[model samples]
Target: MSFLNTLNLTGKDKSVGLLLGLILLSHTERTGAKDKSNVVQKGKGSTAKLKEIMIGRCFNYLGTINPNAGNKDCSKLWEAFLRAFSEKDPCKITKEDYKPFLNMADHDIPIGQSIFWSQTKELILQYTDVTHKVMPLENTLIGFMLDGLNWCGKLSSPGPNYEACPEWNSCTNHSMGSFWRAASENYAMKAQGEVTVLLNGSANAFRENSIFREIELGKLDSKRVTSVHLWIMDNIDGPDKESCGVGSVAVLENILKEKKIKYTCVDNYKPVKMLQCVFKLDRPSCNTGT
Candidate 1:
Protein backbone atom coordinates (compact mmCIF):
# COMPACT_ATOMS: atom_id res chain seq x y z
CA MET A 1 0.00 0.00 0.00
CA SER A 2 1.08 3.53 -0.71
CA PHE A 3 1.91 5.75 2.34
CA LEU A 4 -1.31 7.77 2.20
CA ASN A 5 -3.50 4.65 1.52
CA THR A 6 -1.94 2.94 4.61
CA LEU A 7 -3.11 5.81 6.87
CA ASN A 8 -6.78 5.08 5.82
CA LEU A 9 -7.44 8.82 6.26
CA THR A 10 -10.31 10.71 4.65
CA GLY A 11 -9.46 13.58 2.26
CA LYS A 12 -9.79 16.10 5.13
CA ASP A 13 -7.29 14.23 7.37
CA LYS A 14 -4.72 14.03 4.56
CA SER A 15 -4.98 17.79 3.93
CA VAL A 16 -4.65 18.50 7.67
CA GLY A 17 -1.51 16.36 8.03
CA LEU A 18 0.13 18.02 5.01
CA LEU A 19 -0.68 21.49 6.39
CA LEU A 20 0.75 20.58 9.85
CA GLY A 21 3.90 19.20 8.27
CA LEU A 22 4.44 22.40 6.27
CA ILE A 23 3.98 24.53 9.37
CA LEU A 24 6.47 22.47 11.37
CA LEU A 25 9.05 22.64 8.62
CA SER A 26 8.64 26.36 8.28
CA HIS A 27 8.97 26.87 12.03
CA THR A 28 12.07 24.75 12.21
CA GLU A 29 13.86 26.63 9.44
CA ARG A 30 12.97 30.03 10.90
CA THR A 31 14.08 29.05 14.39
CA GLY A 32 17.43 27.87 13.10
CA ALA A 33 18.02 31.05 11.13
CA LYS A 34 16.98 33.28 14.01
CA ASP A 35 19.32 31.50 16.40
CA LYS A 36 22.28 31.91 14.08
CA SER A 37 21.46 35.56 13.43
CA ASN A 38 21.11 36.30 17.15
CA VAL A 39 24.52 34.87 17.84
CA VAL A 40 26.30 37.14 15.40
CA GLN A 41 24.34 40.21 16.39
CA LYS A 42 24.80 39.66 20.12
CA GLY A 43 28.52 39.12 19.81
CA LYS A 44 29.01 42.12 17.57
CA GLY A 45 26.91 44.43 19.71
CA SER A 46 28.46 43.32 22.99
CA THR A 47 31.99 43.99 21.80
CA ALA A 48 31.09 47.37 20.37
CA LYS A 49 29.39 48.48 23.55
CA LEU A 50 32.25 47.24 25.71
CA LYS A 51 34.75 49.12 23.60
CA GLU A 52 32.83 52.36 24.03
CA ILE A 53 32.52 52.01 27.81
CA MET A 54 36.12 50.91 28.30
CA ILE A 55 37.48 53.85 26.34
CA GLY A 56 35.61 56.29 28.51
CA ARG A 57 36.53 54.47 31.71
CA CYS A 58 40.19 54.44 30.73
CA PHE A 59 40.38 58.23 30.52
CA ASN A 60 38.32 58.71 33.68
CA TYR A 61 40.53 56.28 35.55
CA LEU A 62 43.68 57.99 34.34
CA GLY A 63 42.42 61.35 35.54
CA THR A 64 41.54 59.93 38.92
CA ILE A 65 44.85 58.09 39.30
CA ASN A 66 46.96 60.96 38.01
CA PRO A 67 45.43 64.43 38.12
CA ASN A 68 48.30 65.89 36.13
CA ALA A 69 48.45 63.14 33.53
CA GLY A 70 46.43 65.28 31.14
CA ASN A 71 44.09 64.12 28.39
CA LYS A 72 44.81 60.98 26.34
CA ASP A 73 43.33 59.92 23.02
CA CYS A 74 40.98 57.22 24.19
CA SER A 75 40.08 56.36 20.62
CA LYS A 76 43.61 55.19 20.06
CA LEU A 77 43.35 53.08 23.17
CA TRP A 78 40.20 51.42 21.77
CA GLU A 79 41.93 50.73 18.49
CA ALA A 80 44.89 49.09 20.18
CA PHE A 81 42.65 46.92 22.33
CA LEU A 82 40.64 45.76 19.35
CA ARG A 83 43.69 45.03 17.27
CA ALA A 84 44.84 42.53 19.89
CA PHE A 85 42.11 39.95 19.25
CA SER A 86 40.01 41.10 16.33
CA GLU A 87 40.15 38.86 13.25
CA LYS A 88 42.00 36.20 15.19
CA ASP A 89 40.93 32.68 16.02
CA PRO A 90 39.27 32.97 19.42
CA CYS A 91 40.79 29.72 20.60
CA LYS A 92 44.28 30.79 19.62
CA ILE A 93 44.61 34.29 21.05
CA THR A 94 47.68 34.71 23.21
CA LYS A 95 48.60 36.78 26.26
CA GLU A 96 51.33 38.53 24.34
CA ASP A 97 48.73 39.90 21.96
CA TYR A 98 47.61 42.28 24.70
CA LYS A 99 51.05 43.76 25.45
CA PRO A 100 50.55 46.85 23.32
CA PHE A 101 47.18 47.55 24.90
CA LEU A 102 48.61 47.09 28.40
CA ASN A 103 51.49 49.44 27.68
CA MET A 104 49.14 52.23 26.64
CA ALA A 105 47.92 53.10 30.14
CA ASP A 106 50.20 51.35 32.61
CA HIS A 107 50.28 53.26 35.91
CA ASP A 108 51.75 52.54 39.29
CA ILE A 109 49.31 51.22 41.87
CA PRO A 110 49.42 52.88 45.31
CA ILE A 111 52.02 51.13 47.43
CA GLY A 112 50.73 48.58 49.96
CA GLN A 113 47.11 48.79 48.79
CA SER A 114 47.15 46.41 45.87
CA ILE A 115 44.75 43.53 46.62
CA PHE A 116 44.58 40.11 44.96
CA TRP A 117 41.85 37.55 45.48
CA SER A 118 41.23 33.99 44.35
CA GLN A 119 37.59 33.26 45.27
CA THR A 120 36.63 36.27 47.34
CA LYS A 121 35.24 38.57 44.70
CA GLU A 122 32.17 39.74 46.62
CA LEU A 123 34.03 40.43 49.87
CA ILE A 124 36.80 42.25 48.10
CA LEU A 125 34.33 44.56 46.42
CA GLN A 126 32.58 45.21 49.72
CA TYR A 127 35.83 45.91 51.55
CA THR A 128 37.09 48.23 48.89
CA ASP A 129 33.72 49.92 48.64
CA VAL A 130 33.68 50.67 52.35
CA THR A 131 37.35 51.54 52.93
CA HIS A 132 38.72 52.45 49.51
CA LYS A 133 42.02 51.33 50.99
CA VAL A 134 42.81 48.42 48.73
CA MET A 135 42.80 48.32 44.94
CA PRO A 136 41.89 45.03 43.29
CA LEU A 137 42.76 44.47 39.64
CA GLU A 138 39.11 45.23 38.78
CA ASN A 139 39.73 48.73 40.09
CA THR A 140 42.66 49.25 37.77
CA LEU A 141 42.18 50.43 34.19
CA ILE A 142 42.95 47.07 32.62
CA GLY A 143 40.72 45.17 35.00
CA PHE A 144 37.93 47.70 34.81
CA MET A 145 38.09 47.48 31.05
CA LEU A 146 37.66 43.76 30.72
CA ASP A 147 36.07 42.45 33.90
CA GLY A 148 32.77 40.61 33.36
CA LEU A 149 32.84 41.18 29.65
CA ASN A 150 33.20 38.28 27.22
CA TRP A 151 34.29 38.60 23.64
CA CYS A 152 35.79 36.25 21.11
CA GLY A 153 36.33 36.60 17.38
CA LYS A 154 36.90 34.42 14.37
CA LEU A 155 39.06 35.29 11.35
CA SER A 156 36.13 34.84 9.01
CA SER A 157 33.62 36.66 11.20
CA PRO A 158 33.16 40.42 11.23
CA GLY A 159 33.21 40.69 15.02
CA PRO A 160 33.15 38.66 18.22
CA ASN A 161 31.44 35.26 18.08
CA TYR A 162 28.80 35.81 20.71
CA GLU A 163 26.63 32.73 20.12
CA ALA A 164 29.28 30.30 21.32
CA CYS A 165 32.78 30.80 22.62
CA PRO A 166 35.14 28.37 24.28
CA GLU A 167 34.78 28.04 28.02
CA TRP A 168 37.92 28.51 30.17
CA ASN A 169 38.64 24.78 30.24
CA SER A 170 37.79 24.20 26.60
CA CYS A 171 40.98 25.74 25.30
CA THR A 172 44.34 26.54 26.82
CA ASN A 173 44.51 29.81 24.91
CA HIS A 174 40.93 31.05 24.92
CA SER A 175 40.69 34.77 24.19
CA MET A 176 39.15 36.12 27.40
CA GLY A 177 41.22 33.92 29.69
CA SER A 178 44.43 34.94 27.95
CA PHE A 179 43.53 38.60 28.33
CA TRP A 180 42.97 38.29 32.08
CA ARG A 181 46.12 36.26 32.64
CA ALA A 182 48.13 38.88 30.80
CA ALA A 183 46.39 41.60 32.77
CA SER A 184 47.03 39.78 36.04
CA GLU A 185 50.70 39.45 35.23
CA ASN A 186 50.98 43.13 34.46
CA TYR A 187 49.13 44.03 37.67
CA ALA A 188 51.41 41.80 39.75
CA MET A 189 54.58 43.11 38.19
CA LYS A 190 53.70 46.63 39.34
CA ALA A 191 53.23 45.69 43.00
CA GLN A 192 55.36 47.66 45.43
CA GLY A 193 55.54 47.77 49.19
CA GLU A 194 53.04 45.59 51.07
CA VAL A 195 50.74 43.57 48.81
CA THR A 196 47.56 41.94 50.05
CA VAL A 197 45.88 38.73 48.84
CA LEU A 198 42.45 37.79 50.19
CA LEU A 199 41.90 34.04 50.29
CA ASN A 200 38.93 31.83 51.09
CA GLY A 201 39.67 30.26 54.44
CA SER A 202 36.80 27.79 54.23
CA ALA A 203 38.52 25.89 51.45
CA ASN A 204 42.06 25.45 50.31
CA ALA A 205 43.14 29.07 50.29
CA PHE A 206 45.95 28.49 47.88
CA ARG A 207 46.07 26.21 44.86
CA GLU A 208 49.07 25.36 42.72
CA ASN A 209 47.14 26.12 39.54
CA SER A 210 45.11 29.19 40.59
CA ILE A 211 45.65 32.44 38.82
CA PHE A 212 46.68 33.99 42.12
CA ARG A 213 49.30 31.35 42.92
CA GLU A 214 50.38 30.56 39.41
CA ILE A 215 50.20 33.80 37.46
CA GLU A 216 50.13 36.65 39.94
CA LEU A 217 52.28 35.24 42.69
CA GLY A 218 55.09 34.27 40.39
CA LYS A 219 54.93 37.61 38.64
CA LEU A 220 55.35 39.58 41.87
CA ASP A 221 58.80 41.15 42.06
CA SER A 222 60.31 40.36 45.45
CA LYS A 223 62.54 43.43 45.30
CA ARG A 224 59.70 45.77 44.47
CA VAL A 225 57.07 44.42 46.84
CA THR A 226 58.10 44.80 50.47
CA SER A 227 55.81 42.07 51.81
CA VAL A 228 52.85 39.85 50.92
CA HIS A 229 50.04 39.95 53.48
CA LEU A 230 47.47 37.15 53.29
CA TRP A 231 44.01 37.79 54.66
CA ILE A 232 42.51 34.33 54.99
CA MET A 233 38.76 34.94 55.38
CA ASP A 234 36.20 32.36 56.38
CA ASN A 235 32.47 32.14 55.80
CA ILE A 236 30.43 33.71 58.61
CA ASP A 237 29.20 30.33 59.86
CA GLY A 238 31.79 27.82 59.34
CA PRO A 239 34.31 25.03 58.85
CA ASP A 240 37.49 26.94 58.22
CA LYS A 241 39.85 24.40 56.69
CA GLU A 242 42.79 26.63 55.82
CA SER A 243 44.69 29.27 57.79
CA CYS A 244 48.19 30.61 58.42
CA GLY A 245 49.95 27.33 59.05
CA VAL A 246 47.48 24.83 57.69
CA GLY A 247 46.57 23.11 54.46
CA SER A 248 47.23 25.11 51.31
CA VAL A 249 48.39 28.12 53.26
CA ALA A 250 51.41 26.15 54.50
CA VAL A 251 52.27 25.18 50.98
CA LEU A 252 52.06 28.79 49.90
CA GLU A 253 54.31 29.82 52.77
CA ASN A 254 56.97 27.39 51.67
CA ILE A 255 56.82 28.75 48.13
CA LEU A 256 57.19 32.28 49.44
CA LYS A 257 60.18 31.20 51.49
CA GLU A 258 61.75 29.55 48.50
CA LYS A 259 61.32 32.76 46.56
CA LYS A 260 62.61 34.77 49.52
CA ILE A 261 59.47 36.91 49.45
CA LYS A 262 58.52 38.42 52.82
CA TYR A 263 55.04 37.35 53.82
CA THR A 264 52.44 37.30 56.65
CA CYS A 265 49.11 35.50 57.11
CA VAL A 266 46.14 36.67 59.19
CA ASP A 267 43.38 34.10 59.65
CA ASN A 268 39.83 35.40 59.51
CA TYR A 269 40.95 39.01 59.46
CA LYS A 270 38.53 41.08 61.57
CA PRO A 271 37.73 43.76 59.02
CA VAL A 272 37.03 41.21 56.35
CA LYS A 273 34.68 39.43 58.73
CA MET A 274 33.00 42.75 59.44
CA LEU A 275 32.44 43.28 55.73
CA GLN A 276 30.98 39.80 55.48
CA CYS A 277 28.64 40.68 58.31
CA VAL A 278 27.39 43.66 56.33
CA PHE A 279 26.22 41.19 53.73
CA LYS A 280 25.17 38.49 56.18
CA LEU A 281 23.93 40.49 59.15
CA ASP A 282 22.14 37.51 60.68
CA ARG A 283 25.36 35.57 61.11
CA PRO A 284 26.73 35.67 64.67
CA SER A 285 30.33 35.83 63.56
CA CYS A 286 29.84 39.24 61.99
CA ASN A 287 28.64 40.83 65.27
CA THR A 288 31.07 38.98 67.55
CA GLY A 289 34.36 39.13 65.67
CA THR A 290 37.33 40.93 67.12
Candidate 2:
Protein backbone atom coordinates (compact mmCIF):
# COMPACT_ATOMS: atom_id res chain seq x y z
CA MET A 1 0.00 0.00 0.00
CA SER A 2 2.84 2.40 0.80
CA PHE A 3 4.55 1.71 -2.55
CA LEU A 4 1.25 2.20 -4.51
CA ASN A 5 0.71 5.50 -2.73
CA THR A 6 4.30 6.59 -3.56
CA LEU A 7 3.74 5.86 -7.23
CA ASN A 8 0.41 7.70 -7.10
CA LEU A 9 -1.52 4.73 -8.61
CA THR A 10 -5.00 5.94 -9.57
CA GLY A 11 -8.21 4.28 -10.87
CA LYS A 12 -7.37 5.03 -14.59
CA ASP A 13 -3.91 3.42 -14.24
CA LYS A 14 -5.36 0.37 -12.51
CA SER A 15 -8.05 0.03 -15.18
CA VAL A 16 -5.48 0.30 -17.99
CA GLY A 17 -3.31 -2.45 -16.49
CA LEU A 18 -6.32 -4.73 -16.03
CA LEU A 19 -7.49 -4.13 -19.61
CA LEU A 20 -4.01 -4.99 -20.99
CA GLY A 21 -3.88 -8.20 -18.99
CA LEU A 22 -7.37 -9.25 -20.23
CA ILE A 23 -6.39 -8.62 -23.88
CA LEU A 24 -3.26 -10.78 -23.53
CA LEU A 25 -5.27 -13.60 -21.97
CA SER A 26 -7.94 -13.46 -24.65
CA HIS A 27 -5.31 -13.55 -27.44
CA THR A 28 -3.58 -16.56 -25.93
CA GLU A 29 -6.87 -18.44 -25.61
CA ARG A 30 -7.88 -17.61 -29.19
CA THR A 31 -4.52 -18.75 -30.57
CA GLY A 32 -4.73 -22.04 -28.71
CA ALA A 33 -8.27 -22.65 -29.97
CA LYS A 34 -7.21 -21.91 -33.54
CA ASP A 35 -4.30 -24.35 -33.30
CA LYS A 36 -6.53 -27.11 -32.02
CA SER A 37 -9.07 -26.41 -34.75
CA ASN A 38 -6.33 -26.57 -37.39
CA VAL A 39 -5.11 -29.95 -36.15
CA VAL A 40 -8.63 -31.38 -36.30
CA GLN A 41 -9.20 -29.84 -39.71
CA LYS A 42 -5.93 -31.28 -41.06
CA GLY A 43 -6.74 -34.79 -39.85
CA LYS A 44 -10.20 -34.66 -41.43
CA GLY A 45 -8.81 -33.21 -44.63
CA SER A 46 -6.22 -35.99 -44.98
CA THR A 47 -8.83 -38.71 -44.46
CA ALA A 48 -11.13 -37.13 -47.03
CA LYS A 49 -8.27 -36.85 -49.49
CA LEU A 50 -7.48 -40.55 -49.15
CA LYS A 51 -11.10 -41.48 -49.67
CA GLU A 52 -11.29 -39.29 -52.75
CA ILE A 53 -8.20 -40.84 -54.31
CA MET A 54 -9.30 -44.41 -53.61
CA ILE A 55 -12.89 -43.97 -54.77
CA GLY A 56 -11.95 -41.85 -57.75
CA ARG A 57 -9.43 -44.36 -58.98
CA CYS A 58 -11.92 -47.18 -58.54
CA PHE A 59 -14.57 -45.37 -60.54
CA ASN A 60 -12.10 -44.46 -63.23
CA TYR A 61 -11.01 -48.09 -63.61
CA LEU A 62 -14.60 -49.27 -63.70
CA GLY A 63 -15.53 -46.70 -66.30
CA THR A 64 -12.61 -47.73 -68.45
CA ILE A 65 -13.67 -51.37 -68.24
CA ASN A 66 -17.43 -50.89 -68.39
CA PRO A 67 -18.96 -47.60 -69.55
CA ASN A 68 -22.13 -48.08 -67.50
CA ALA A 69 -20.03 -48.41 -64.34
CA GLY A 70 -19.61 -44.61 -64.29
CA ASN A 71 -23.34 -44.18 -63.58
CA LYS A 72 -22.90 -45.56 -60.05
CA ASP A 73 -22.36 -42.93 -57.35
CA CYS A 74 -18.85 -43.82 -56.17
CA SER A 75 -19.00 -41.30 -53.34
CA LYS A 76 -21.81 -43.36 -51.89
CA LEU A 77 -19.68 -46.42 -52.39
CA TRP A 78 -16.87 -44.74 -50.48
CA GLU A 79 -19.26 -43.91 -47.66
CA ALA A 80 -20.50 -47.50 -47.49
CA PHE A 81 -16.96 -48.89 -47.55
CA LEU A 82 -15.80 -46.58 -44.76
CA ARG A 83 -18.84 -47.41 -42.67
CA ALA A 84 -17.66 -51.06 -42.62
CA PHE A 85 -14.62 -50.30 -40.46
CA SER A 86 -15.10 -46.76 -39.22
CA GLU A 87 -16.11 -46.36 -35.57
CA LYS A 88 -15.36 -50.04 -34.99
CA ASP A 89 -12.56 -51.90 -33.29
CA PRO A 90 -9.77 -52.33 -35.85
CA CYS A 91 -9.13 -55.87 -34.61
CA LYS A 92 -12.83 -56.76 -34.79
CA ILE A 93 -13.54 -55.80 -38.40
CA THR A 94 -14.64 -58.91 -40.29
CA LYS A 95 -15.05 -60.00 -43.90
CA GLU A 96 -18.82 -59.82 -43.48
CA ASP A 97 -18.58 -56.13 -42.65
CA TYR A 98 -17.30 -55.50 -46.18
CA LYS A 99 -20.23 -57.26 -47.88
CA PRO A 100 -22.06 -53.99 -48.51
CA PHE A 101 -19.21 -52.46 -50.49
CA LEU A 102 -18.62 -55.76 -52.29
CA ASN A 103 -22.23 -55.90 -53.37
CA MET A 104 -21.95 -52.45 -54.85
CA ALA A 105 -18.84 -53.35 -56.86
CA ASP A 106 -19.80 -56.94 -57.68
CA HIS A 107 -19.26 -58.00 -61.26
CA ASP A 108 -18.23 -61.11 -63.10
CA ILE A 109 -14.54 -61.73 -63.49
CA PRO A 110 -13.55 -62.78 -67.01
CA ILE A 111 -13.23 -66.57 -66.97
CA GLY A 112 -9.85 -68.14 -67.81
CA GLN A 113 -8.31 -64.67 -67.57
CA SER A 114 -8.04 -64.73 -63.77
CA ILE A 115 -4.45 -64.87 -62.49
CA PHE A 116 -3.45 -65.54 -58.89
CA TRP A 117 0.02 -64.74 -57.55
CA SER A 118 2.06 -65.42 -54.44
CA GLN A 119 5.30 -63.42 -53.96
CA THR A 120 5.23 -62.70 -57.68
CA LYS A 121 3.37 -59.41 -57.62
CA GLU A 122 5.88 -57.47 -59.72
CA LEU A 123 6.34 -60.11 -62.41
CA ILE A 124 2.63 -60.86 -62.63
CA LEU A 125 1.74 -57.18 -63.01
CA GLN A 126 4.34 -56.77 -65.69
CA TYR A 127 3.25 -59.96 -67.42
CA THR A 128 -0.41 -58.99 -67.32
CA ASP A 129 0.24 -55.47 -68.55
CA VAL A 130 2.47 -56.59 -71.39
CA THR A 131 0.37 -59.55 -72.45
CA HIS A 132 -3.10 -58.32 -71.45
CA LYS A 133 -4.07 -61.99 -71.26
CA VAL A 134 -4.47 -62.23 -67.50
CA MET A 135 -6.44 -60.24 -64.94
CA PRO A 136 -4.77 -60.12 -61.55
CA LEU A 137 -6.59 -59.00 -58.44
CA GLU A 138 -5.04 -55.54 -58.69
CA ASN A 139 -6.74 -55.13 -62.07
CA THR A 140 -10.15 -55.51 -60.44
CA LEU A 141 -12.09 -52.44 -59.35
CA ILE A 142 -12.15 -53.17 -55.59
CA GLY A 143 -8.52 -54.26 -55.52
CA PHE A 144 -7.47 -51.18 -57.48
CA MET A 145 -9.30 -49.02 -54.96
CA LEU A 146 -7.64 -50.20 -51.73
CA ASP A 147 -4.31 -51.68 -52.84
CA GLY A 148 -1.28 -50.43 -50.84
CA LEU A 149 -3.36 -48.21 -48.59
CA ASN A 150 -3.42 -48.39 -44.77
CA TRP A 151 -6.55 -47.26 -42.96
CA CYS A 152 -8.45 -47.80 -39.74
CA GLY A 153 -10.88 -45.85 -37.56
CA LYS A 154 -12.05 -45.62 -33.96
CA LEU A 155 -15.49 -45.23 -32.41
CA SER A 156 -14.33 -41.97 -30.86
CA SER A 157 -12.85 -40.62 -34.11
CA PRO A 158 -14.84 -39.23 -37.01
CA GLY A 159 -12.57 -40.53 -39.78
CA PRO A 160 -9.75 -43.01 -40.44
CA ASN A 161 -6.98 -43.04 -37.86
CA TYR A 162 -4.02 -42.16 -40.02
CA GLU A 163 -1.79 -42.09 -36.95
CA ALA A 164 -1.56 -45.87 -36.62
CA CYS A 165 -3.01 -49.04 -38.14
CA PRO A 166 -2.23 -52.69 -37.49
CA GLU A 167 0.13 -54.58 -39.76
CA TRP A 168 -0.88 -57.76 -41.63
CA ASN A 169 0.62 -60.15 -39.05
CA SER A 170 -0.27 -58.02 -36.02
CA CYS A 171 -3.83 -59.32 -35.76
CA THR A 172 -5.93 -62.10 -37.27
CA ASN A 173 -8.96 -59.92 -37.97
CA HIS A 174 -7.16 -56.74 -39.02
CA SER A 175 -9.15 -54.48 -41.32
CA MET A 176 -6.92 -54.83 -44.37
CA GLY A 177 -6.47 -58.54 -43.84
CA SER A 178 -10.22 -59.05 -43.63
CA PHE A 179 -10.78 -57.04 -46.76
CA TRP A 180 -8.24 -59.09 -48.73
CA ARG A 181 -9.67 -62.33 -47.43
CA ALA A 182 -13.12 -61.26 -48.57
CA ALA A 183 -11.84 -60.00 -51.90
CA SER A 184 -9.76 -63.10 -52.58
CA GLU A 185 -12.73 -65.29 -51.84
CA ASN A 186 -14.83 -63.35 -54.31
CA TYR A 187 -12.15 -63.47 -56.98
CA ALA A 188 -11.59 -67.18 -56.56
CA MET A 189 -15.27 -68.10 -56.50
CA LYS A 190 -15.92 -66.13 -59.66
CA ALA A 191 -13.03 -67.68 -61.59
CA GLN A 192 -13.86 -70.28 -64.22
CA GLY A 193 -12.17 -72.39 -66.91
CA GLU A 194 -8.41 -72.47 -66.54
CA VAL A 195 -6.90 -70.24 -63.83
CA THR A 196 -3.23 -69.34 -63.82
CA VAL A 197 -1.18 -68.89 -60.66
CA LEU A 198 2.27 -67.31 -60.68
CA LEU A 199 4.47 -68.54 -57.82
CA ASN A 200 8.00 -67.69 -56.79
CA GLY A 201 10.07 -70.85 -57.24
CA SER A 202 12.99 -69.51 -55.18
CA ALA A 203 11.12 -69.57 -51.88
CA ASN A 204 8.48 -71.79 -50.30
CA ALA A 205 6.33 -71.39 -53.40
CA PHE A 206 3.26 -73.14 -52.08
CA ARG A 207 2.49 -72.77 -48.39
CA GLU A 208 -0.80 -73.83 -46.83
CA ASN A 209 -1.22 -70.45 -45.13
CA SER A 210 -0.69 -68.42 -48.32
CA ILE A 211 -3.75 -66.64 -49.72
CA PHE A 212 -3.36 -68.55 -52.98
CA ARG A 213 -3.26 -71.88 -51.20
CA GLU A 214 -5.88 -71.23 -48.51
CA ILE A 215 -8.41 -68.84 -50.04
CA GLU A 216 -7.98 -69.20 -53.80
CA LEU A 217 -7.46 -72.95 -53.87
CA GLY A 218 -10.39 -73.67 -51.59
CA LYS A 219 -12.79 -71.35 -53.40
CA LEU A 220 -12.11 -72.63 -56.92
CA ASP A 221 -15.10 -74.72 -57.97
CA SER A 222 -14.06 -77.99 -59.54
CA LYS A 223 -17.25 -78.05 -61.56
CA ARG A 224 -16.51 -74.64 -63.08
CA VAL A 225 -12.72 -74.65 -63.47
CA THR A 226 -11.28 -77.19 -65.91
CA SER A 227 -7.72 -76.97 -64.61
CA VAL A 228 -5.12 -74.85 -62.78
CA HIS A 229 -1.90 -73.73 -64.45
CA LEU A 230 0.93 -73.18 -62.01
CA TRP A 231 3.80 -71.07 -63.30
CA ILE A 232 6.75 -71.45 -60.91
CA MET A 233 9.01 -68.49 -61.67
CA ASP A 234 12.50 -68.45 -60.17
CA ASN A 235 15.04 -65.63 -59.95
CA ILE A 236 17.59 -65.21 -62.73
CA ASP A 237 20.43 -65.45 -60.17
CA GLY A 238 19.90 -69.22 -59.54
CA PRO A 239 18.90 -71.00 -56.25
CA ASP A 240 15.77 -72.49 -57.72
CA LYS A 241 14.40 -74.52 -54.83
CA GLU A 242 10.98 -75.80 -55.94
CA SER A 243 9.68 -77.35 -59.17
CA CYS A 244 7.00 -79.65 -60.56
CA GLY A 245 6.63 -82.89 -58.52
CA VAL A 246 9.35 -81.66 -56.17
CA GLY A 247 9.43 -80.01 -52.73
CA SER A 248 6.41 -77.88 -51.68
CA VAL A 249 5.05 -77.82 -55.23
CA ALA A 250 4.59 -81.59 -55.09
CA VAL A 251 2.52 -81.08 -51.94
CA LEU A 252 0.44 -78.59 -53.91
CA GLU A 253 -0.03 -81.14 -56.71
CA ASN A 254 -1.16 -83.73 -54.16
CA ILE A 255 -3.76 -81.30 -52.85
CA LEU A 256 -5.05 -80.50 -56.32
CA LYS A 257 -5.15 -84.17 -57.21
CA GLU A 258 -7.08 -84.91 -54.05
CA LYS A 259 -9.54 -82.20 -55.01
CA LYS A 260 -9.88 -83.84 -58.46
CA ILE A 261 -8.86 -80.50 -60.01
CA LYS A 262 -6.46 -81.19 -62.89
CA TYR A 263 -3.32 -79.02 -62.70
CA THR A 264 -0.05 -78.57 -64.61
CA CYS A 265 3.16 -77.07 -63.16
CA VAL A 266 5.76 -75.42 -65.36
CA ASP A 267 9.12 -74.48 -63.92
CA ASN A 268 10.46 -71.19 -65.37
CA TYR A 269 8.11 -71.04 -68.29
CA LYS A 270 9.96 -69.61 -71.28
CA PRO A 271 7.77 -66.55 -71.69
CA VAL A 272 8.14 -65.64 -68.02
CA LYS A 273 11.85 -66.39 -68.24
CA MET A 274 12.05 -64.13 -71.27
CA LEU A 275 10.34 -61.45 -69.26
CA GLN A 276 12.92 -61.93 -66.50
CA CYS A 277 15.66 -61.65 -69.07
CA VAL A 278 14.37 -58.23 -69.99
CA PHE A 279 15.42 -57.10 -66.51
CA LYS A 280 18.62 -59.17 -66.10
CA LEU A 281 20.07 -59.92 -69.50
CA ASP A 282 23.48 -60.93 -68.14
CA ARG A 283 22.26 -63.61 -65.71
CA PRO A 284 23.12 -67.08 -67.03
CA SER A 285 19.96 -68.54 -65.54
CA CYS A 286 17.86 -65.96 -67.36
CA ASN A 287 19.71 -66.62 -70.64
CA THR A 288 19.58 -70.41 -70.37
CA GLY A 289 15.97 -70.53 -69.17
CA THR A 290 17.05 -73.04 -66.50
lDDT for every model? 0.79, 0.80
Best by TM-score: 2
Predicted candidate 2 versus true structure: per-residue lDDT over 1-290, tens digit per residue? 54345556688886666666678789989877754432342222123467878878877887785554345668887888899888776767999999999888776677798899998898998898889888788887778888767777655566787766655576788777899999999989988999898898999999778999889889989999999999998877857899888898898899889889999889998888888889687878765644
Clashing pairs in 1: none
Give TM per candidate: 0.79, 0.81
Q: Which stretches of candidate 1 lie over 4 Å from their true place?
A: 1-48, 63-71
lDDT of model 1 at position 20: 67
Give the Å error, residue 62, model 1: 3.6
In model 1, which range of ten residues has the least summed lDDT? 37-46
Evaluate model 2: give its lDDT.
0.80
RMSD of 2: 9.8
